[model samples]
Target: MDIATYTAFCLTAGPLTILMVIGLWKLFEKAGRPGWESLIPVYNVYIILKISGRPWWLLLLLLIPGINIIIGVGVAVDFIKSYGKFKISQNAAIILLPFICLPKWGFDKNTRYLGPSATISFHEKHRKDLQKSTTREWAEAVIFAVVAATLIRSLFIEAYTIPTPSMESSLLVGDFLFVSKINYGARLPITPVAFPFAHHTMPIIGGKAYWNGIKLPYFRLPGLGDIKKGDVVVFNFPMDADSPFYRPVDKRENYIKRCQGTPGDTLSLLNAKVYVNDEAAITPSHGEMEYMVRNDGSSFNRQLARDLHLSDIQQFTNQDFMMNMTAQSAALLKQQAGIKSVRPNIRFNGVYDPEVFPHNPKFRWNVDNLGPIIIPKKGWTVKLDSLTLPIYRRAIEVYEQNKLQVNDNHISINGKPADSYTFKLNYYWMMGDNRHNSEDSRFWGFVPEDHIVGKALFVWMSWDAETHKIRWSRVMRMIK
Candidate 1:
């Protein structure tokens, strides 16, 4: 584990567990149970649940994927109410900073445990009998809702809107998707304190949505499965790896792309076809490619174009049209009356794209003619040279957090002369399905494993922005 990850673990899990132990000890003593019971882990939760007027079987809820969050907060509310601490701010503190609130309530001189007594019954009756003010009730309700939603979004699934056509045809622009964090295990928030519902930027105000005061350590729960080749994944943009401002892993921009290469796999693009470990990659069934089309002096039908969801269409002449279309869509277009021919727009080999990954003048790699480059894996060492330096420089210096300097015919890491370096983390290569029109790993570089967000799950909703209509067919469509 890295220093930052260790620090975060101490700040959250260590302190929270200790505080809960102390608080539950005192609370348990007052409730006529053994104070030592609170020191136990799973048993402590069961004791607290029993004391909080809830069923003990509900502890099983913690084992479920998404439902655990609700159980956690519900238990917190019960724990707070067990002590007769009914104020809204106290409730908020209990949910947000239980490390502080639980200890404060437990050890404080005046805060008495009012549980398992006739007073406890009276307090419950009073609370249910409109004894609390209406405003307080609403405020507590809203706070609970926000806390539950935030936990759910952070740990299980989050709804994301597709803002670009980068993954067109496979995941179209305007598709509202539910990204499943548990598929690859949800990553713990590095920046734990942030504005609710707002991502990196606040709406309308146009500033950062998070504070840098307390950065938590990075960690991820055990995932349901590992990321495999050809999976549609969401990850943070690796370009932000060089930003001057501090952006936590989760707070960086969320980008959805297909994982073309995994760690230790050699990835290359030959004539626009991806080859992984010297084998042809299996493309998605609905994957799209740009095509140069010729029609016999007639415009394409508007209704047919709409049905095919063709957005990028340009007419070079009366008889020629350049369109970005899926193989399926292109085949349909060929059957249309007055159409002459449809040929995919393929970029030639050895054509240099200056904006490609590493941005080195020495490399003439273009989007369709990239690497036979090896993706770095954890603990894998490679001899460094002018040829390999540019390809892995950012991965070593930025993602791995090392000071790397290239000097006269030699490379130094942390001021030591080193001819080779071992990677600390696995790296992945990502690309958009819209082969001809994406700014992906081709434009950037390898995506560090830490930058991975989650797997794209389902299209819960999709909107046709240009036509201002709902795409009913895409609603609740499972993302393959």
Candidate 2:
């Protein structure tokens, strides 16, 4: 839990509840004398209408705000006529009575009246009606349900609309997706400003200065082994978590298309084919580059969409077929739709290296090519002169020089205690299944495992650009 999270909770629950209360009060006009007496909880005896010489139990109407105003005026009129003691009759109370008291109606304390003990018979007849004024109850229920549901959704599963083609052919713009918070194990609620000075993250200063700042209960860890190669996954955007815009956690804007290159394996994409540890990757050909999933896409998506239809399939014609998004949003959508990743699990020969190994083989790598580098682990150690690169050196500096500060003793990376510190978080190599089209780890480098969100379980729906129809059959189909 952090300061921002707690503030959101209070804004939703506390102040809103109080506003509902005051709103109800303003309805019945009970702020001011005689029938104004209905505002007294115990004195009203659960049936406050008799005090105004009208039907009993209009008190329930007092629970409603807008309608309460109409009823309050009616009740004030009826009570005045019943009071022979005061010259202020029903109509007189509504008009001239304002000259004396500002409220000019019921619920005022200063005014006094002697009204007839009438309406006992009317109260008895409509007792059941008074008990159930469904209109008021239903209105109140609707207001509360909407408020409660919004709170749950904001904190639990937030719904996002995809906006680009990078992850295209999979996630489309206007395609609504729900990202679950608990999927990556959410942080426990911590009071934002508990201890002071230590959690000193005040306005002008960045977050570092607090004592009891941003603490979590440290519950169960996120699940392991769920994310596999070729499985679409979402994660927090690495470069800009602190920006004013809380960007999508998915790798398109923050999400991307990348082939999974496993630990200890050398991988690369030369020309247009993918290679994992010097072996060619087996890919699923999804036909030509017409529109996949949906038919109603731009001018470019029509060809493949029709081919995938394979003739017998029905055509889609609904407006839901195409997503019209802003330029920025469209970029994100395109990335999501761009390529389909295939898990690297089989053994095959490299496209360039002709020396094939029947069982296991090894070969050299290039700039457009890669591999032979070992996955750095918790206990791994290396001689600075023996094996050194800019990336490796940077990692060492982060783990040893910046993160670890031991008193006259060497530090460690991750949990592997050692005289020679090593890798901190688990790391992985990611690349686009579309060899030439993706910008990935081969360029920016390895991804840390702590950023993982969840394996994309399924392709929920597809839109056809040509026919402009939504394909219902694809909904809920497991990703291959």
Candidate 3:
């Protein structure tokens, strides 16, 4: 089985290892040595040295990097000689720790003096050969739990720290929480070219050359809903993926905006209040608001958020109306002292009527009040001319707009054209619940369905963003 699939087995080995160690320690105690000697780290080593009849200075061998190899080999040679009943060579046991007890039980005729034992091999040994069996079991259980936690954290859900204010207010610069991949599905394990811990199959763990050479056989999970307008989202920085030192952009590291538009939804920023299907958009909830229950506790909007430096991007917050502009209003604003010239994208220039104020909530580029654009979806096809720049077409070129030669013609999407078109996969739009601040579909376009790992289901704990302090109030909080 792959390394990931072997996790359970690796964990299982911990208990077995501890049990065997304790069993042998008991056998040593039966020979009149102190049983407590097995519990001390350095002293334990000394005991092992005594049992192997090696000099204490040899223990220093473990401190050296490559030097331990030779010393370890020697340790095995001597350790085999310590017990006549355990005839297996130390080198053999060291190489095959999983099966180490077999020799003690199968080959040895000596009866274990401590725990119960039915035979010479460890497989045949019983509780009689063990000293302080509870300690062994406890140690094994704890170690196994730690190992399992590490593996799961490394391979599955990983904690991310927001270090920038980019996604401010929503996911603060120092907010700490976990992003899960198992909710969607997991990638198959791939062996590393170098390190043992690099068992993850994601391209990031593979390194540049390693990742480039890896061809993944697709394993897909169902595509979830496109991040709605005004949803906070997190995703890999598209540009970083090509870099050698790529890292997932933290909430503070990237842009987090309301998902003004979703696939197939036509979006356009009218004076700037986000418009959807020609209607005013709503913020059903910005985020989960922390609250103290009546003498107890309670919570709402489990989503993360905080009002910060973002809410002031636009003027006229009093009214939620698209640019109610007109030539007269533009001239007035332009003529207004200290107010800058109206510099909107060329497409919408002068389109704002002085009589109207953009879309609603008085237009702004900030996440809260922006958009009315459509994101393209899969299985849905639009004729070439019907598509335009920065909309449905923008997403196609991201993952599916790849190039190919058809017979003699060359082609590319967005600009150039290729011979054939193959929609190998679909794309998704992911967003965080905190609408006002999130780096989501708006910036990165779409999350290719194939790259989707999993869903974020729960928040086990929460950490303050700016102070790097753990928020005790957020512990045991259920993620919406």
Candidate 4:
């Protein structure tokens, strides 16, 4: 993280931490334990477990990532019960308003520590009032199951299905994948209060699934490794921040693509080949692109097209055709009868593509031939000028949430005149393997760090909707 981001996080988390500590200190003293015990880290958790009458071994569960949340909530509920608070509203106060409720209960003249709520004797004495109906028992079970599944899905792995052909031949449409959040660190939910298992919309009812009233700052746990070039990643769509569809970062639509350029790397494409820092980047073996094929005015073979996995085949004339297929498939098609030539459909350099990134006439860039532009790194400052503004404006003003304006050949950020700007978060360049068919970074721009979701690990299941059957060979196949 950059210094700016770190400072912002500290500013938000510091006050909350202090309040919780003060609350815990008083509560510990009320339990006949040293108030200083609340100041310690792991030891404080141990004390909480002891006060609630939970086993000492439960401390080990607190060390876990996803399971820790569940265990901590249980411990808190039991601790509140020990204070003789039994109402559902009181339990919610203890869990959601701990800084307020804990201190309030601890300092109250009438509030006194009873016995450990988890003990058998306490439960036996209150058994008459605690008896629950079958319906209530079933409801509680369902609630626990939902919370457990939500935690696992948010912090460990999530199931995602391919809905487009942008990653075709690499990750096919209808492929069900298990994306690993731990690989690139599990990003804590920015919109925490949401319908379980729903992305951004309610099922069977057309409405927002999440409440936007409470928004959390972006934070992520330590991951196994950083995102590298060629890693398949799932990220929230950045364009959803535009007008008429202003969605929060986490609530944006999810998109999967291959990471072609990492932070601080200079990336470019020439003749449909990717280059990083002037060196040829690794290409996906099964990646596909459009190819122009010419024939001897003979009828095309439908069986040959199916066998080669050719998609979006369009015939301009009896002798001219265009198809999307991998290089290996193209080579095989070239050796067939009546085929005259098969060549990549690459757009020449200096051809301006308005749909491409930056969208400037000065660049004259296209999908096949793009920039040698540098991907922004955290703390990397760039001089603000007419030429660079078009490239970096959206990232600075939108993603980083800054006020930027250009007036009379001058630049002003946050209402202050500025000649340069420093990026707070690292930025990446993503591209689809299906070069001719994807609306990726080549069209939109950089992907900020906060928009990243997880890494695509493997395909657990694959279905071929066209044939109404399963692709058995693709099942359990690990993504490259």
lDDT of predicted model 3: 0.43
Q: Write the per-residue lDDT of candidate 1 for residues 92-130, one digit (tens) a residue.
A: 788778778777777888876666343468565785674
Compared with the true structure, all predictions reach lDDT values of 0.84, 0.42, 0.43, 0.90
For all predictions, the C-alpha RMSD in Å is 3.1, 17.9, 17.1, 2.4
User: Which candidate leads in lDDT?
Assistant: 4
Question: What's the TM-score of each model vs. the native?
Answer: 0.88, 0.40, 0.44, 0.93
Point out where model 2 deviates above 4 Å: 1-161, 170-226, 241-259, 263-265, 270-272, 277-281, 284-368, 372-375, 382-387, 393-421, 463-468
Q: Which regions of candidate 1 are displaced past 4 Å?
A: 7-38, 50-59, 63-66, 117-120, 124-130, 244-246, 294-310, 315-321, 332-341
By TM-score rank, best first, the candidates go 4, 1, 3, 2
lDDT per residue for candidate 4 within 1-480, as digits (tens), equals 545767877887788788888878888888999999999999998898888888999888888776777788888888878778876678778877887887788778787778785346656888987898898788778877887788888889999999999998999999999999889888998888888899988999878999998777888887889999999999999999987768899999999999999999999999899999999999899999999999999999999999999999999999999999999999999999999999999999989999999999988999999998989999899999988899999999999988898889999998999999999899999999998999899999999999999999999999999999999999999999
381-470 in candidate 2: lDDT tens per residue?
A: 654332333345444543222333333444344344444444544555665433323345655555555444444445566655546887
Clash number for candidate 2: 56
Query: What does the lDDT come to for candidate 2?
Result: 0.42
Enumerate clash totals for all models, in the order shown.
1, 56, 72, 0
Q: Which runs in model 4 stand beyond 4 Å of their true positions? A: 1-19, 39-42, 55-64, 84-92, 107-111, 117-119
Candidate 4 positional error at 46, Å: 3.0
